[model samples]
Target: MPFSNKVPTIYDPRIGSPMLDAEEANFEEIALKSLGGFVLVLNDNGEIYYASENVEGYLGFHQSDILHQPIFDLIHSEDRDDIRQQLDINFHIPTSSPSNQFDIFAPPNSKYLERNVNARFRCLLDNTCGFLRIDMRGKLMSLHGLPSSYVMGRSSTGPVLGMICVCT
Candidate 1:
C-alpha cells in the first residue's frame, strides 16, 4: 500500500487522494472569475509581490508601474495617523482571536476612490518595504457597526487614507 498526502497530512494515507468538492483546486479560478477584483499579496514589508490583472482597476496604475512600490503610498493622507494606530492595535492583538483581528479607520482625504491610485513610500531601510500586513476585512467592518462605505485597511508607509483602520 502506498501512502497518500494524508499519511503525513490526514488520517487516510493508503487510499487514493481524497477528491475535493467541485470547489477543490478550482477555488482561485472560480473566485477570480466571479469577483473580478485585484488581489495583492504583500510581503511583511509591504512590497507588491503578487498583483492580479484586476490591480489596474483597483489602483488605476498599471502593474508594471507599481511593482516594488510600498503599499503605504496609495493611502490618502488624512487617514494616516488613524491607520497607524490601527496597525499598532492589530500587531498587538492575539493571533487566536479572529474577532480582534480587523479594524475600521479610514485614511485622511480619501473618500471611496472614484478611481484607483496608489503611491509607494520608502522606508528607513532604504531598500526594504516597511509595511507588514494589517489584515483588514470589509465584511468584518460592517459586522462591527461600521458603515459599508467606510474604508478599512493598514499601510506600512505611515497611516491610512480613506480605508478605516479598526483598532483593538
Candidate 2:
C-alpha cells in the first residue's frame, strides 16, 4: 500500500481558508464568551463582513445567514439611522480651524476610535421576543492591512473603514 500525504483544513473546503487559524479561532471564541457578547465586523457601507460564531447564541442568526448582508436589515427600523451615523467616518471628522489645522491633518496613531451605540435588533429566534435591545461598544478601525478578500465591498489598498462591534 502507498501512503498519501495531505494537510487537513479546519474550515469548509468549499469556502476556502478563513483568515483565522484553528488556534486563533478558539482564542477569539473564549474571549468573546468571557465578555458575554458577540463580535461583529462591518464595512464602511454597513455590510457585515464577519461575525463571531457566538452571534447565533445571542441573536439567533447563523453566521452564514448574515455575512455579506447589510447590517441595517437586522437592526430595528427606528434605530438604523443612528447606527449608520455612528459608523460613518465623516460624521466624526473634526472641523478644520486655524488652531486645529494640524490636528485635522494628523490624527492619532491609534487604529481604533471609540464608538458606542445602543439599539434594538430584530430577534429571529422567537417571534414573541420581537426586537432585543443591545448595547454595542467598539472601535472604528482602519482597515489598512486587512485582507480585501475577507472584506465585502473594497480592495485591500484603498482606505477602508471597519468596526468591531461587541454587542451585549
- Highest-TM-score candidate: 2
**Per-residue lDDT over 106-159 for candidate 1, one digit per residue giving the tens place of the 0 to 100 score:** 453122221122333222333345422223321111123323333234233433
Clashing pairs in 2: none
Q: List model 2 lDDT by residue over 42-85, tens digit each.
A: 87778887888888887889989999899899998999898888
Assess each prediction's global lDDT (C-alpha) against the native.
0.39, 0.73
After best superposition, candidate 1 residue 61: deviation in angstroms?
A: 1.3
Where is model 1 more than 4 Å wrong at Cα?
A: 1-30, 82-168
Judge candidate 2 against the unseen true structure and give its global Cα lDDT, from 0 to 1: 0.73
Measured on C-alpha atoms, candidate 1 has an lDDT of: 0.39
Q: How many clashing residue pairs, candidate 1? A: 23
Tell me the spans in candidate 2 whose CA falls farther than 4 Å from its real position. 1-26, 95-112, 144-158
Q: How far out, in Å, is residue 31 in model 1? A: 3.0
